[model samples]
Target: MNPPKRPGRRAVCLLVLFSVWWVAVATVGFSAETVSSEPQVKAAFLINFAKYADWPSNAFEKANSPIVLGVMGDNKVSEELQKVIAGRVINGREIVLKRANSIDEAGACHILFISNAEQQHTPTVLDQVKGHVLTVGESPEFLEKGGVINLVRKDQKIALEVNLTAADKAQIKISSKLLSVATLVKGKAN
Candidate 1:
């Protein structure tokens, strides 16, 4: 009888890659029961952003400091984000959601989701938070204005637009698994 053949190295590598990609997509993508509103989807993105991102050591007060996600300009998004992240811990740090009253207040957060309601103040807000936090906005001019990441709407589907240069300048390291699914963009250098 012929001996059973083992999977080749290339096959193993492909399997590993596929598993990682599946976990990333499955966790962020909408499941049947959770299939709901746009705000909830954005909230899921925010939660996964914390998972697939690496912040500078000094960004936190200590090893145990909570990672804060601040939301500005839309009450629905903030509420949704809070509901999704409650009792969850990310990167060994507790996840906390804050409804920011102003752009200045959000500057201190680890991830800031600037809602479409704040569209008019995009430039100014981006200027204030540049190189400070991960900024996710839905506007077309968001990444051009120095946001680290933007959630773009294309072909009636939600996609991620990443500004690698902006993220590098901010000292943030986004995982390759996350970048693989993003539409990369170049940001204006300082």
Candidate 2:
């Protein structure tokens, strides 16, 4: 069956805005979209990441709420993430984005995207999130630092590196389908 048509002026506006961002990023050096596709690709990755990940029961405070993606810094990425997950649902839970200034402020997030600019505190951030949240980041050393997913820019597109053992330790399941396209690291083949 064919998919339903997307709705409304706001949707169109968002698309246009992102297309501009995508083009600009593709043309410019590593800005926000240079490393990631602003909100669009990031959100898509987050949602798709959810599909690839399995959270144990009780991962959410309420089974019915949307899974929260906690972004622990101020950056263009966070703005995009909020826009992208605006009205989506994940595993019967609605998708939400929460901003955190400090790791301690970031409670109850299922996925955490650590902006590359926050490298100084990555170790502590990872420590705070370990075994609870699936972490994604742009830092190359993220995996080495114990983060689960390292998002990299290759040929101007976002690629992924995953640590299966870390993910498993977080009680998160990685889909073999997703793994097929990702660079698996530091663990047995998924």
Best by TM-score: 1
Across 125-165, the per-residue lDDT of candidate 1 in tens digits comes to: 77776435888888887888888889988877789999988
C-alpha local distance difference test of each model: 0.83, 0.75
Model 2 Cα lDDT, one tens digit per residue, 1-190: 2343657666777788899999987777656445554456766786678777878877766668577787866467777776677778766777777876666655467888888778888888777653468888778788888788988878878888999888887888888888888998784212
After superposition, candidate 1 runs with Cα above 4 Å error: 1-33
Assess candidate 1 and give its TM-score to the true structure. Answer: 0.79
Clashes of each: 0, 2
User: With candidate 2 superimposed using the best TM-score fit, by how many Å does residue 184's alpha carbon deviate from the native?
Assistant: 0.7
